[model samples]
Target: MLNFFKKKAALVWAKKHVLKSGEFKKNSVKNQEALLLSLVKTAEKTLFGREHDFESIRSVKEFQDRVPVADYEDLKPYIERVKKGQANILWTETPEYFAKTSGTTSGSKYIPISKEGMPFQIAGAQSALFHYIAQKNNADFVNGKMIFLQGSPEMEEVFGIKTGRLSGIVAHHIPGYLQKNRLPSWNTNIMEDWEAKVEKIIEETEHENMTLISGIPPWLIMYFEKLTEKHGKKIKQLFPNLQLLVTGGVNYEPYRDKMNDLLGGKVDIIQTFPASEGFFAFQDDYTKEGLLLLTDHGIFYEFIPLEEYGKPEARRLTLKDVELNKDYALILSTNSGLWAYSIGDVVRFTGKDPYRILVSGRTKHFTSAFGEHVIAFEVEEAMKATVEKNAAQITEFHLAPQVNPTEGLPYHEWLIEFEKEPENLELFRSELDEQLRARNTYYDDLITGNILQQLHITPLKKNAFHEYAKSQGKLGGQNKTPRLANDRKIADLLEIYKL
Candidate 1:
C-alpha cells in the first residue's frame, strides 16, 4: 500500500513538474510576475511587508524600488531580533526553525525558515525524483529505501525556535512511513562525532538495497571507500540495484573518475542546487546543459552582474530581464521573509526560454591578483580534465596565489590532498595548468609571456584535509573545504601535511 502511494506520488509529481517546466518555457514572464505578486500579497501585513510598502508593488520595478538587494550580513540584526523571540519581523509569523550555516569572518549565521518556506525546500527534493520518474519511468526505485546521507536530526531551541543544520531540519520532517526505510538509524544519525557516525552508517547500510545515494561528492566518496573495504568489491557488486546518484554542494566533475571506478556502471546522476537559503534548481534533463530553475516556487529571482556586485547602483535583473550566458550573482526574494537576498552564488543562464542556469562560483571566491581572473567553475573544469586524463582522485584541495612574499616569480599554488594518488604528479600539474590557460585568455598570456611561473602542486598527506576540517570543528556535514582562497590562510594552515 505504501509502495503504491509512493509510485502514485512520483508519477503525479512528474506530470505536474513537467507541465510546470513547459508552462514556464512559454510564459516565464507571466508566471514569474504572478509568483512575485502572490508573495507580496501574502506577506503585505508582515514587518518587512509594511516597511517596504509591499501593498504598493504593482510591478517588478516598484518591488525593486522598495527593496534593495542585501546579503546575510544586512539582515543579521533582524535575525538576531527573531532569535530573541520577536514575531513578524521579517515573515508573517516568527520562523519555526533556524538553519545554522558555517561561521564566516563575522561568525555563524542562522537563516530563518518560516512555516511557508519549508515546502519550497521539500519541493526541490521531490522534483529530483519526479524528473527521474518522468524521464526513466522506473518507480521500483521508490519501493526500496531512498537513502539520503545527510546531517542528523537532533534539535535544539533558541528563543523558543528550533534550530539545526538544514539537512537535519529536513530529516525531522521525513514522514514516519518514509522514515522507516532511511539509513543511519536515529541513534547513529544523532552522534555528533562524524568519524563514529560514518563507521556505524557503513556497518548498517553495507548490505542494504540502496537504489539512490545522494549527498555532496567528497563525503559520498568516503562512504564508497568504506563500502569497498567492507565488501571487497565495487558498489555494483554490493548493490546492483542502485540506479541514481544525486550530488550537490560541490562540483562533481573532478570526482567522476574515482566514482566511476567505484560504482562501475552507467548510473544516472541528477544534480541539484540546494542551499540553506532555499533549494533553487535541479537537473531536470539527462543532458548536463543546466539545472531547471523553479520559477513558480515561492521564490522571486533576481540577478546582478558579477562586476556590479556590491556596487551602490548595481542593476538587478528580474527573470524577464536576465540574458543568456552572462555571469551574474544570483539573488532571491522568498516567502521565508528573505527579501532581495544575495545568497552569494554566481551563476550563468544556459537557457532563457524555460530558464536554466549553471552555478559559476561564489562572488568573493576568485583569483585576479595578477589580473588573470580565474573562477572556481573554470578551475574545477580544468581539474576535471586533468583528473580524468591521469585517473587520479582528489579528496580535497585549495588554490591560492603565491605573490612576491615568496621571493620569486609569483605563481598559483595548488595544495591537493589526494586519496587516489596520480601516477605522474608533475604531468597532472602541467596538464591542469594548460587546461586553465586554454580556458582563460589572460591566464594564457601570462604563462606564454613568462610573467608567471607554471602552477605548483603540493601533495598533502593522507586525511590532511579531514584533520584540518576537524581542527576547525567542521569535520563533516555541509562544511566544504574552501576550493579557492584569496590569501594563503587556508594553504598555510594545511601546509603541515605537505609532502
Candidate 2:
C-alpha cells in the first residue's frame, strides 16, 4: 500500500514537472534521430551496458532485417528461463517487472518491463489528458478525478511481482498519490477475482466524482450499459462533474455513437494506442486520426514495410526513411531491453517530422479468407458510415469472417447490437457493402465475382458483448470481444446468426 502511494506521488510530481519536454516538439527528423540515439545510449548504460551483450545490431535496418519475425512463440524460451527464476536471454538482469497477458491470438506473452518502462506508460496515459488540455486548454478538466476503466488489480498477484501484461504493470505504476482516490481501487488489485473487482467498481462509483474515465473500448461499453441500467437517469445526476471519457485497448469506432448517447454527449471522448510491448502512440488530437508517436520519450521508434519484414525479399526503414501515407509494421527497440521486437501492429503516417500516425490495425487483425484483405479500420469505417447514414442507434458490434465450403461462398458476417433498429437495415447493409467495396478494389472484385457474399446482420440484446464477456469470466478491465473473429473457435462465440 505504501508502494502504491509512492508511485502515485511520483506520478503526480511527474505530471506537473515532466510532461511536454521540449524534446517532443523538435520538429526535424534529424532532431528525432538525435533524441532516439540519446535514449538508446541511456538504455544501453542502464539496461545491458555499452556493448549490447544479447545480440549485435549494426544499423536500424540491419537490426530489423536480421531479426526473424517472431510472435510470443519465439520469445517463449526467454519466458521459460525467467519462470525458472533465471535472468532472461533478451536482457541480462531480471526486469523490474514483466507485463503479462494471454495475447489475443498468441495466448500468453510475458513482456519484460523495467523501471524506465513505467514512465513511458505513465507518460502515454498522461498524454491523453495533455492532448485534451492542448485542444481545449481547459484547466478545470485538469483538476477533477479521472476514473480509469482498467483491468482488475487482481492481475498483480496473478502475475506476481512482475507487472502481468501491459495494463497490469501500468496499474501498478499509476502515480502513487492518485491510486486511492482517482483510480478505481477494485480494478487495480490483481489479487481479487475479476467478478469481485467489477462488483466493487459498480458499488463505489455509483455516487462518485468520475470526471475522466479510461479503459479499453469494449469493457467501457459493457460497464456503461450496466451503469445506465442500474441508475436509470441517475448516472449523470451522480457524476455531474464528468467531462471527459478516454478509451483504448481496441478501436472506438463501433461504440462511439452509443457511448456519446449514454454519456449525454457532453464529455469529450478520447482514444489512445497503448500496448504491453510499449506505448507506441496516442491520439493527441480530437479527430482521432494520426496518433502522434512519443518520439522524445525513453523508447526509440522504427518501422518496416509490412510486405518486406518477414518475406525473403525484404528491407527495413528507420524513422528517417519512412514515407508518408504508407502502411508499415511496427518494430521497437524499447528502453525495456526489447531489441528489434516486431510488435505485430501496423500504422500509417499522416504528418511528418515530429511524426503522427494512425494505427491501421494489427497485422493479424485482417481477413483474407476470400482473398479480400479487409482490415479492422476498413470494417470500422464501413460500420461507422452505415450507422451514420441510417441514423441507427447501436451500442456495440463485431464482424466474423466466414467461409462456406459447400458453396465456396466467402463473406463477412456482422453481429450487431442496435440500441434501436432502423427502419431500413437492408438498405443500410447494401449501402455499407457498396462503400466497403469502393474503398478496397480487392473487396470490390470479390463482391463483383460473388466470391464474397453480402453482409449478414445479426442483432442482439443491448448488452450482449458485456454479458458475453461476464459469462466467460473475462468481463472487466481490458477484456473485450474481438472486433473481427477469423477462426472457428472465435466464430462460435461471436456468430449470433448465419444466413
Candidate 3:
C-alpha cells in the first residue's frame, strides 16, 4: 500500500512535467530567461535574505555582471570558517551535507551542500532521466528493475563527519522515492563494506529479470566480469532482463567492446554528465546527437570561450546568447548560492531550443606540451572508431604525452590491453594520430616541425587501469584514470617507455 502511494505520486509528477520535457525543451530562450529571472528572485529570498540581507538584484544584468567569479579555492576560506562553527561568507545556515570530489589538481575537495541544493540536483537528474524515456517512448522500461553499482556506505565520513560524496548522497535517497517493486532490492553496496557487498550481489544473482543497470563504467565492467567468472554460463540465466545500460564517472571508450561482450550484445547505452556540483546533462534520446539541457532547472548558464579562460576580453554569454559549434568553458550561477562558479568543463553547443550539447572535455584534460592539443573526448571517440575499424576488443587503457628528447617532438603514447592483439597495431596508431591532428591543427603544426612524432602503442595486462586506480586510493566517486597528463609527474608515472 505504501509503495502504491509512492508510485502514484511519481506517476502524477511524471504526467505533470516530466512528460513535457520535450515541450519544455522547445521552450523559447526568451521564456527560459524570464523563468530564470523569477527563480533567481526566489533564490535570493531563500538563500541570501538572512545572510547578506539581499532583497533582490537591481536588474538582470546587474545579477550577472556585479557578482564576481568564484572558484573552489575561493570557497576554501568560507568552508574553513564554517568548519570553525562560525557564520559562512555565503549562506548563514549550516549545510546539511557536503559532497566530496577528488580535486583534479589537488587531493580532494568537499563542497558544502544545503538541503535546497540537494533537491535541485535530484530534480535535474530525474528530469533528465524522464526526458530520455519520454523521447524514446521507453516509459515501460522504468517499471522494471535497475541496479546501480555505487560508492560504499563507508565513504560517508570525511574528517569524522557522517556524510558522503555527491553520488552516494543521491543514491542514499533513491530507495525512499522509487517504486519498491520496480527496483531490485539487491544493492552492490560498493562502499567500504566490500565483504558484505560481494555477498549481497552474489545472493541477488539468483533473482531473475533485472532489466537495467547503471554505474561508473570502469567499476561496472570489473563487477560484471567478476560475476561472469563466479557464475560461468549460469550468469546470463540468472539476470535475464537487463537490456539497458547507463554509465558515467569515466570515459567508456577503452572498455566499450569488452562491455558489449559481457552484456551479450550492443545494449541500449546512455551516458550521463553529473557531478558533485549538479546534473550538467544526459543522453535524452539514443538517436539524438547530443544531450538536451535541463533549462527550466534553477541553474543559470554562461559560457566563456575556451581559448580565453583567464583573458580579460574573454567573451561570456548567457544561455539566451550563445552561438553554436564553438567550445566554451561552462560558468554556472545556481539557486545553491553559487555565483559565476567555473565548473571546469568545456562544452560545444550542438542544438538550440531543447539546447543540446556535447561535453568536450575538462579545461585541463588536454595535451599541450609541444603545442599538440588533444582533448579527452576526441581521443575517446578516435579510439572507439579505431577499435571498430580494426574489429578488435580493448579491455582498458590510459594515454600520456611523450616528448622526444632530441627532436623535441611531442607525441601521444597509449598504454592499452586488448582482448586479442590486432595485426595492424602500427596502422591503428597512425590512424588515431591522423584523426587527432585533423581535429586539432596544433597537433599538425607540432608534427610538421618535428615537435610531435609518430604515436606509440603499448599493450598492458588485463585490469591494468582498474588495478592502477585501486592502488591510487581512488576506487570510486568522480575519480577517473587520467588519459592525458599535462605535468611530468603523472606523465612519468603512467608512461610505459621513454621517448
> For candidate 1, what is the lDDT?
0.84
Provide the overall lDDT of each model, using Cα atoms, as 2-decimal numbers.
Answer: 0.84, 0.66, 0.66
Query: Which tens-of-lDDT digit does each residue in 1-499 have in candidate 1?
Result: 8788887887777877777667656777787788888888888987778989998889888998999888888888888888999887888788988998875764878998888889879878887778888888776677675667778788889988999899999997765756777787888888888888889988888878888888888788778888898789999888888888889987677777778888877788998999888998898888658998888777888899987888999999888778887889998888888889988889999997678898988988888778887888889889888888998888778999888645767899999988788899889999999999988888899989988989999999988888898998888787788798788888889999998
Top candidate (lDDT) = 1
Which is the winner by TM-score between candidate 1 and candidate 3?
1
lDDT of 3 at 438: 72
TM-score against native, each model = 0.94, 0.85, 0.86
On a 0 to 1 TM-score scale, where does candidate 1 land against the true structure? 0.94
- Give candidate 1 misplaced runs (Cα > 4 Å): 1-13, 405-407, 419-423, 448-450
User: What range of 10 consecutive residues in model 2 has the weakest lDDT sum?
Assistant: 46-55
Model 2: what TM-score? 0.85
Per-residue error for 47 in candidate 1, Å, reads: 3.0
Model 3, 342: alpha-carbon shift in Å? 1.1
Q: What are the per-model numbers of colliding residue pairs?
A: 0, 20, 4
Error of 2 at 345 (Å): 1.7
Q: What lDDT does candidate 1 reach at residue 422?
A: 83
Query: What TM-score would candidate 3 get against the native?
Result: 0.86
Q: Which stretches of candidate 2 lie over 4 Å from their true place?
A: 1-22, 31-58, 104-107, 154-163, 186-196, 405-408, 496-499
What's model 2's lDDT at 190?
A: 49
